[model samples]
Target chain A: MKKVLFLFVVLFGSCAKLDNNLYNNDNKIKEYKLDDYTGEQDFILDDSYHIPPGLVTLLTLPSQADGESSSTEIKAIYIGDVSKINSDTVLLYCHGNKDHMDFYWQRAKLLAHVNGKNKYGVLMMDYRGYGLSKGKPGEKGMYADVSACMQWLKNNGLNNNRLIIYGFSMGTASACELSANAAPMLPDKIILEAPFASVAVMIQDASQLNMPADYFTDLKIDNAEEIKKCDQPLLWLHGKSDNFLNYKTHGQAVYKNYHGRYKESILIEGADHGQVPSQMGFENYLKLIGSFIRKP
Target chain B: MRLIRFICIFLFLIFICFCSPTQLVKPLQKGQRAAAITYGGPLIKFAGAPIPIPFTTLGFSYGLTSKITGYASLHTTSLIFGNLQTTVGGLFSLYEQENKFGLTVSPAIQTAYNIRNKTGFRIWPTLDLNAYYHPLQKPSFVYIGANSWFELSSLRAHNEPQANHIIPNIHAGYMLVKTKWQHQFEIKYLGLGIPNLPGVVDYIGISHKGALGIYYSLIRKF
Candidate 1:
């Protein structure tokens, strides 16, 4: 009996950890405290906050059933007038790894204040295993999380014509996956910031070696492949000196491969990872983004 | 006496829970075959709590001659950046004093790759030295060993590319032989801090402290 129990322990412990090697949710707390606000709800912008004049709407969208993850709602923060959902263009923002939505609050605020004051609606959500969402993060699970949020916008009466998709770093994989295969709900325009081409290309760039695709894992997020199939208007922004993901190998490669209807790229000279927007200066960055959105 | 030795080995296992040093291989008789599984991982302290990250290995060995044994093994860890290794090696006895002391040497080749990253591969040439001592008329033995490997490729971890070329591990253990059943427990100290080229730094742990590791295995000889 003891030997049997020991074998059982060893076999049971062989299961892989979900957070291992991928999701870095060191602060996994769902109740994010932003200026004394807890949970997702209404936050009145007082005089102290530099954000545009608008009410920040916070809520959790119901999760859809996925075989790979436990069903749980995703937490999101939308900055803008809720009444403008029908008229204004909405940016579905996908953030990078580490931490949660709280870390991305400032970016959301800046994006909302972009095109004059309160001119755009920005919606950002935490992927599963991030923030208050309950589930392990995997390739399929993350895709499901973004799809649910997109559905929430659709249920609120927003469609592809008035919706734009924006992805940053690791989030670029999610955005590209959606834009490539999600035809019925395809986004009108796509913006990629410091994006990697794919996990395979990333490895080749980092290690400078040619290896098989399934040498380590089958979790292939080939944005290069996805971008080729996507025909949306695209804007690619990258820092020339990005240390984590090389601009020459990853960002530029994806931009070159993109055979979209319309495309543009801005390779900042001195910017590093996570510093493009600030390095481009707030006013000039807003101007570039405003022009892209306003173009017919 | 048995209880005291068990306690000592248990304490030593905790002390070296942060490393994955090599294990001592006991040579078997000609035509003998054996199988074993080992669980080992580095103990990383997170928010003041010691969490053990498991790396598991499964192996099988066969005696080609009375003094030579050959083996193959596969190993994996929980970290995504950590690569899975497949290793093949052979053990050769230098000198033997059946009831007193024995010395052996092993040299092996290990190939590492990741299932998720799917890009690079690292090759390691390793050498293991082991010495065993058995008191007269006793079935229990005390052993000491050291493993050295040359890192020959650039490996990625913590989202950074690190090129390390040297790694060494030291270990000690106890073993008991009971008919066809053999039990072994080991504690190891893996050398951390592989110096990189100028202007390059590699992260081995969350802090500056070295890693320790432990291993236990039950071998079924046939």
Candidate 2:
């Protein structure tokens, strides 16, 4: 009996030690320093154009896992008037897998401009291991990162009815997970641009073979199951000409499986993955978004 | 002498309680097993951008339980597409009896050598812990457990010496076969910290590991 108890203690102690080591080895917090900087800058509007803008104040909000002693930091960018953001409306943007939030400064500025007059404060966050955020990027870590950001918004007086989540490609999974689990306080609407059904299914479609998606089971986000549970408004945008993620399989599956209050699927004929709005004319896309937001 | 005998008897009783014959009967009686192989290519980053390198993997696994019996395939990546690379591993389980449930755990560990080339090796060690429930005529079960893995290579392209990371996983799979051989699917969440690097790259951490696969196995009675 004593030996058995000793074995149990040893197992439990070893697990705790391993957890500590993982925390100690992570150096996310020591990376980049965030500050409020306002300066004239050169911005790239697209592949072929550069736009100059007046001085803009960039505030970097740091994020960390709950109850951790280490300094792993995640970065969130708050642009425009912080006071304009309230419990009625806010735009929370999640960028794609590559690059940091700094790279998307131009996009963030554009989003804020579109919102106009600080009517909707735009909050863009970096996933762990992306940009200046600390810690490794994994399924659990990403979920935690998203949850932490949501909590931060809530602490600052934001709620479901006032929140709108926008995700691009890989970020779509995180958005879906957050939306499904948001529950009693779900977001008002969710937008997935060029979304894939699930990492596993995406792989299967990409390979075009009979191989199973078990290898990706480790990275699986199960968005199909998640989307079914989301009862809020859902907007799925996919370009018909997209080659990276098959439109018929990924985006269509999501649109088909969404059992929500108001679900809509928009197929941009000549638009590619990231070029939908620009290719089809930004005016139309913006109109669609504006109308959705203004809908009573 | 009397004291030693008493101690021995006490240990024997405890062992019997935890590892009773009833716990080992059902799944072993059923003959159930299977294996599969899967391949995952290089993970694509930006659209229209060049993929650093693509990979191909093959895997095999088996399992047996009271309600379901099956095995699995061990390969580099799922038969899907993504940037992450996995080593190899398998599992087996038992669930179903008039009044009992059973489980087993197995794990695999692999490494990613370079972001450009996408190469690495793995070492996996597993453990299984399960529980059983009885509701009159049948037994329904639930399980919670962990597995540990060690990455053996560096993640950098230049072959810089990298710190080894350990991932702990927890999951629950249902038993489809009898108490001996069963069919099961488990969901595990992987967590590990980031390695020390530089700049924005430093804050980029990798810690999520999850999988959905089937398991099959066969039990032998002694």
Summarize candidate 2's per-residue lDDT along B1-222 as a digit string, tens digits. 222222222221111101101111123224444332222121122233422122223333333444433332222222122223334343444444445544543433332222222332223332333443433335434455654544333431112233333434344444344543343333333222322111111011243112221222232222
lDDT digits (tens) for residues A101-194 of candidate 1: 8766666666776677678888888887787776666677778788887887887778898888899988899889999995336788898998
Q: Go through the candidates in order and give each one's C-alpha lDDT.
A: 0.67, 0.48
* RMSD over all Cα atoms, model 1: 9.3
Clashes of 1: 16
Chain B TM-score (model 1 vs. true structure): 0.73
Error of 1 at B72 (Å): 3.2
Report candidate 1's fraction of native contacts: 0.03
The runs of at least 3 residues in candidate 1 whose Cα sits more than 4 Å from the true structure, single-residue gaps closed, are A1-14, A17-21, A26-49, A65-72, A133-138, A155-157, A199-220, A240-243, A246-253, A269-272, B1-71, B76-85, B90-202, B205-222
Q: Model 2 — TM-score against the truth?
A: 0.50
